[model samples]
Target: MPKAVLALGANQGDPARQLALAGAAIAAHPDIEVLAESSVIVTPPWGKTDQAEFHNAALLIETGLSPLDLLDFCLATEAGIGRVRLEKWGPRVIDIDLIAYDRLEMESERLTLPHPYAHQRDFVLTPLREIAPDIADWLVNRIGTSSA
Candidate 1:
């Protein structure tokens, strides 16, 4: 099974509960194994900053699903949690980002491996560093230094 890293966040509704629901959904997936999860942290909004602070966390998983399949699963999970896409970087009930997939790197219409912005966001890096320091280091080395 390939190991992947996921970054999770939510600012609207019950942020903590939203994160917990996402974790539960991921754990329930037959094709995925939850290897590790980081403690949730409150973070100031990134990108569009006018929204409420977000609760962020990270997950390390071993999965049988391909990258695109995992991305699709994440999208489905967000929708299931009441995410509505109304604006770019808008507040949401849940946001599940496929931050990394093994060591694979690729860009498609639907997904990108080793997420394009993983190294730049503390909300993504801090929680990620807690659960998977090796991956966090790899991401910084591969990309650039993080502002965190």
Candidate 2:
């Protein structure tokens, strides 16, 4: 089973509760097993700074699903929790991002592995550091090696 690193956040409608519910739903998915979860951390908005602060956390999961399948699962979880994509980086009820999928690196119209901007966001890094510090190093290495 591949281990996937995921980031979860919410800035609207009881942020902590939203994260909790998202975590539970993700764990209950047949293809995913929650191996570890980080403590939620409070952080300010990212791209859109006008919104309320967000509660963020990271999850390490063991899964049988492929990367795209996992992305679908994350999207489903978001939609199930009433996520609305009204604006870029706008406040949301919930947000689940696939930060990494094992060591796979690829990008398409649908998704990007290792999440393109994860390294640039403290909100994503702090909780992720708690669960998988090595990922930070991996990301650094990837960044160093990438020509783009």
TM-scores for every predicted model: 0.96, 0.95
Tens-digit per-residue lDDT, 24-95, candidate 2: 999999989998899999988988898899999999999999999999989999999999899988989999
The window of 10 residues in a row where model 1 has the poorest summed lDDT is 139-148
State the displacement of the C-alpha of residue 121, model 2, in Å, after optimal TM-score superposition: 0.9
RMSD of every prediction: 2.2, 1.3
Give candidate 2's whole-model lDDT.
Answer: 0.89
lDDT of 1 by residue, 1-148 (tens): 9999989999998999999999999999999999999999999999999989999999999999999999999999999999999999889999999999998988888887778888889999999989999999999888775323
Candidate that scores best on TM-score: 1
